[model samples]
Each structure stands twice: as structure tokens, then as C-alpha cells.
Target: MKYFAVFFFVFISNVFFAQEKENGTLVNGIIKDDTTGNLLSGVNIINVNTVKGAISDDKGVFHLQAFANDTLHISLLGYKSIKVKVTNDWIKNKTTTIQLTQKAYALEEVVIRPYVLTGYLEIDAKLIPTRENYRYSISGLKEGYEAGEYSPNAFGRVLGSIFNPADMLYNFFGKKPKELRRLKEMKKDDTVKNLLASKFDRETISALLGVSKSEIAEIMERCNYSESFVKTANDLQIMDAISACYEEYKILKR
Candidate 1:
């Protein structure tokens, strides 16, 4: 009974130690350019044979967690690759500083002619008009050119058709004759004509027209229109467009 108890105690201790070993560890490090000593961001650090990895942040700091026995590989776009072994001591003391040496490249010096036309000299630069252009144009006319009595449902349906070509085709040719007839009747409504005549806010109009915001602003002011309409325009994702529109609108408003 005494010998059996000793064996069971040893077995339990072994299992605990095994579990502790499997828990692994984490190592934090920074990547820097060797030549300039500048911090390098987006350095790729991975295990040598395994798929585990982490990318350095904008501050060149990175933290990687893995088994203490695992090997690590580090690489940067313009730097030489490095492989390092993660030892038990290294795991216990977490932080590390990794400096990646930049790879030197040899370039054969050659002078090339400036007027080397490789392909077609005159490429077609004309913008190809898609169905989106037409839909937006109609939308612009309805929203900007005429704002009063805007049919949100009709406009939404037309916009939806531009996105869903299959749905548009189904609606045009499908067996729902009653729905098609109703849509035709709605299209010919007199209110639609009145709605199209209301002046749209310059910014909103420009967005719908897919014109430069500034350009539309200028057009509106020059035409003696109110900048008050600008409030209807949403925050645009395109920075350049927004900037240009704001600049032009300022000048035109002046």
C-alpha cells in the first residue's frame, strides 16, 4: 500500500509539470532598421516551422506567445530574414530587442531612353458610361435640380435596380404584368415633374450628380442659389472630393 501511494503521488506531480510546460509563454520585442536605427513597423515574426506569427505595430513593438521550445523567424520587406531559438530562459524573461539588418542589393547601372513608347500611344481615356451614371443623373435631376415632392420610394427603386441587374431584368420581363403596369403609371405622375424642379442643396446635388463638390458649390452660388442646401449632403468618404468641394464652395459663396 505504501509503494502504491508513492507511485500515485509521482504520477500526479508529473501530470502537473506536464500541464505547466504545455502552458507555454510570451515574448515581447521591437524591430528596428540596423543602418538608420529607425523603428520598423509591420515586421513579420513567425515560428520557423509552424504557422504561428505576429506583425509589429506602427511603433515597431511586437508580442509573440508560443511554446518555449519553438523556433521563431523574423522578416521585413527590405531587411534580411532571421531565425532565433526560443529557450526556456528566454521565455522566463519575456522582453527582447530584435534588430533586423537591411539586405543589400546590387543594381547594374544602365541608361534608358525617355521616349520609349512600349504600347499603344493614344489610349482611350474617355470615361465609359455605365448604367450607374444614368441612374445617378436621374437622381441628381430629381434631388438637386428639383427637390420638392421627391418620391423617395421611386428613387430608391431606381437606385436598387442599378445595383441589382438581375432584379431589374426580372421586373422588366417577369409575369407580373400588374406590378409593371403600376410602375409605368407611377413613372408618368405629374408630382414627379414638380419634384424634379426643386433646387437641391449644392453638396447633396453634387454628390448625386457625381460632380466635384466644389464645382457644384460654385455653380449653385454663381446661379444665385442658397448654400443652405449644403446641409443635406452627408459626410463623404472621398477626402479629395470633399476638400475640393469645400474650397470651391467657399470661393463661390464669397
Candidate 2:
């Protein structure tokens, strides 16, 4: 009876330790420039699965809560972004260092020709291309508009996302309520907004939201955003669109 009691106590203690490690722990990390070996500040660090974020201080040090296997996306303007995975070692050691490579751009020479006004309404109107934006809204849902490209099936797409219980948007955003809940938090952070504004690639947003690039494109399409906007808009614009769409989705489901 004494032996059995000792074994049971040991088993329970081991099980609790394993579960605590699996859930996660706070990890400390430092960011630096790969070429210069200097500490980089204001870098964005986000846990993709948890949607929890941290920014590197002036000393390029940051700390975040992360589980083993969780992906951490690190990004800074004018530098190539990189993702790092949290290993069991990282949780155990509790510290890591990441270095980012700066992006280079070549300047191209160009000749500029200024447009001259014809001073005639008909001639000027013909010379200048007109940009028209269209807005489409569903009957029962809140009012909103899709700008840039117009789709013939826009109504059907928006209606399906709202009315169909098993739609992709429903499954995608619904299953990850905690992740989507951080959209507002990301939007409110100026550092995040600035970083996203400079980036055209959907990597940061996709990683932060735990979605793939293809899935992001589909979500935009379903939300009635045009192909042109999805292709050209920066990550900040995409984040805003997703937030708006998610808000509407939450309202409709309620």
C-alpha cells in the first residue's frame, strides 16, 4: 500500500509538469541586423496561433508567451521578414536571438512628361480616365460597400457568407474566435499598423491570423473585395477589410 501511494504521487506530478510545458511559457528574444550585427528596434513579433504580439524595445529585446511548435513572425520595415518556430528547447532555455536581412532596391531612371490641360470640358474628360467605385449590400445585413472591382456574382457571394451555416468564411473565422478577437488589438497598435502599411505581401497578416495566402485571397473575394485590391493593396488594407467582414459575420450569426 505504501509503494502504490508513492508511485501514484510521482505519476501525477509528472503528468502536471508535462501539461504545463505543453501549454507554453514566456520566451525572451532579441532582434538584430544580420549585416551590421547591430540591435534592431521596433520590430514586430507575433505568435501566429495565439495572436498575442510584442514589440522589440530600443535594445531590440522582447518577451512573449508561446507554446512549443508555435510560429513567431518577426518583421521590420526595409528588412526581409522571417518566421521562427518555438521548440521545446526554446521554452526550456527561455531565450533566443533572431537576425533580419535588409531588403535592397535598385533605382530606375525615368523621363517625366507633364499632362497639359486642354481647357475644354469634353476634351479634358476624354483625356483623363475616370475611376468609378461601386458598392453592393445584402438586404438583411448591415450596410457596407466593396470598392475597386465589380463582380456579377457579388450579391450571391455576400449572401452565401451570411446565410449559409457551413460556408468557408463561417468555418474559417468561427473556429478561431480567439485569433480573430485580436484584429482590433492589432489595428489599434501604431507599430503594427506602420509595419503592415509598408508590406504588400500577406505574410504577416496570414501568420498572425493563422491562415494561408490562398485562403486570404478567397476570404477577400467572398467579402466582395475586387481582385485588383487584393492584388495591390498593402497588408494594412487587407487587415481592415477582414476586420470589417468579421464584425458583420459576428452580428449576423448572433
User: lDDT tens string, model 2, 1-254?
Assistant: 99999999999999977866775688999899999999998898877766677899999999987889988888888898889999988888899889999999889999997767799988888887564445544222266444522456645565577667778887787788887898888866565667777778898988788889999998887877877667877787788878777876776667
RMSD of 1: 22.1
Over the full model, what C-alpha lDDT does candidate 1 score relative to the true structure? 0.48
lDDT (0 to 1) per candidate: 0.48, 0.79
Q: Which regions of candidate 2 are displaced past 4 Å?
A: 1-23, 109-117, 134-153, 160-201, 210-222, 226-234, 246-254
State, as a TM-score between 0 and 1, how close model 1 is to the true structure: 0.35
Which candidate achieves the best lDDT against the true structure? 2
For candidate 2, the clash count comes to: 0
Which stretches of candidate 1 lie above 4 Å from their native place? 1-20, 109-254
User: Mind giving the per-residue lDDT tens digits that candidate 1 earns over 1-254?
Assistant: 99999999999999977865665566788888877888899776754323345778998998776677776667665677677777777777787777889878999989985554446635332333222111111222234331111333433433443345465322332333332233223224333222222323232223223345565454333322234433343322121222332343334334
Worst 10 residues of 2 by lDDT: 132-141
Residue 159 local lDDT, model 2: 55
